[model samples]
Target: MSHAPVFDAVIHAPGRLQICAILSSVDDAEFAMIRDAIKVSDSVLSKHLKQLEEAGYVKLTKQAENGRQRTWIALTPAGRKTFAAHVAELQRLAALTAPEPMGQGFAG
Candidate 1:
């Protein structure tokens, strides 16, 4: 069986998208690391994280690390699958929109 790729709007925003990209590459990442990598303010990142969390696309955990509270973020199984499908859909769209050879498609 085959199905069309799924595009997740929740993960489509630039910041959220970048967050998913980073999380997809690892089992987990520190919230600070993600914030720095995405170069967004705490409130902005927090807002995006809240949205993603509401969509059940990400999991957040807070714990003590070296006498400091650290927050870690990771994609849920659903998140990973949705993100993969979203990427595939984007690739498909790019392929469909790619320019063809000049003057090669018209018939006289």
Candidate 2:
């Protein structure tokens, strides 16, 4: 029997989903970069990042850069797997509901 699609509630939120997408494309991203990309305030991004971090789907590191502290974020191996599965499920659903091509089922 086919298995059900994997939909992780933790990563399902719009902001969190965007975060995962961004992290999946690169080795790591600065906290500010993700915030800007998601167009959220610092506190809002921090809240979402915290959730992902707690769920073991993201890793955050803080270091000094040019004498200033900066935070970098990246998805863990498990995060990548989970995100991929979630996306695959979404694609599958879309395909299942997609409309058929025109002029294929009717003949003049």
Candidate 3:
């Protein structure tokens, strides 16, 4: 949403980053699907999710399907905005460290 770049410590964690990246592209994702995509244990994923939830970055929904309660996760509007900003900030920072073009530094 063209938000100002921000460094979000909560989303900066690798696991959480992956989670956000995955969720950012989808309308909603299942808990097990995310867990498998990120290759983390249930508890590990839950921990990361709780952190995002605490920050109001994600919304979790529980539904009954075939007598099983399925949990679906999605990023809140704020989360999407912040994630975009955080990614932008990271891009900006990475650009700062980019190497100079070949021969640009050489005074021929």
Candidate 4:
């Protein structure tokens, strides 16, 4: 059986949603991973990531390893919940726009 989602926002922005979706499926990922997945320039991704981070939907951490600093990102508990809810909302919206069953199309 299929279940609907319960997200609130539409999250239609390409890079932003992709970021959230990719991050949702991982425990944590590096900046490059996210940047590559979204296929955006470093500055572009950084701007979008900053927005998510400021919204409390993502967490960023910096650590030094072998004299180099690495940045990692992970969804917060709240971020996970918010992203899940937003995806659900999108599902419900899509359901509304889908064609009706045969012989019952175009409901007013």
Best by lDDT: 3
Error of 4 at 30 (Å): 0.3
Best by TM-score: 3
Model 4: per-residue Cα lDDT at residue 44: 91
Write model 3 residue lDDT over 1-108, tens digit each, in one string. Answer: 558899999999999999999999999999999999999999999999999999999999999999999999999999999999999999999999969898789676
Tell me how far the alpha carbon of residue 97 in candidate 4 is from the true structure, in angstroms, after superposition.
1.4
RMSD of each: 5.1, 5.2, 4.6, 5.4
Residue 97 lDDT, candidate 3, scale 0-100? 100
Deviating ranges (above 4 Å) for candidate 3: 100-108
Off by over 4 Å in 4: 1-12, 100-108
| TM-score, per-candidate, Cα-based | 0.86, 0.86, 0.90, 0.79
Worst 10 residues of 1 by lDDT: 1-10
The TM-score that candidate 2 achieves is 0.86
**Candidate achieving higher lDDT, 3 or 4:** 3
Query: lDDT values of the candidates?
Result: 0.92, 0.92, 0.97, 0.81
Query: Which pairs, if any, clash in model 2?
Result: none
Ranking by TM-score: 3, 1, 2, 4
lDDT string, candidate 1, 1-108, tens digits: 144688788999999999999999999999999999999998999999999999999999999989999999999998888888899888888888869788789786
Q: Tens digit of lDDT per residue, candidate 2, span 1-108? A: 134468889999999999999999999999999999999999999999999999999999999989999999999998988888888888778888958788777665
Using TM-score as the measure, name the better of candidate 1 and candidate 2.
1
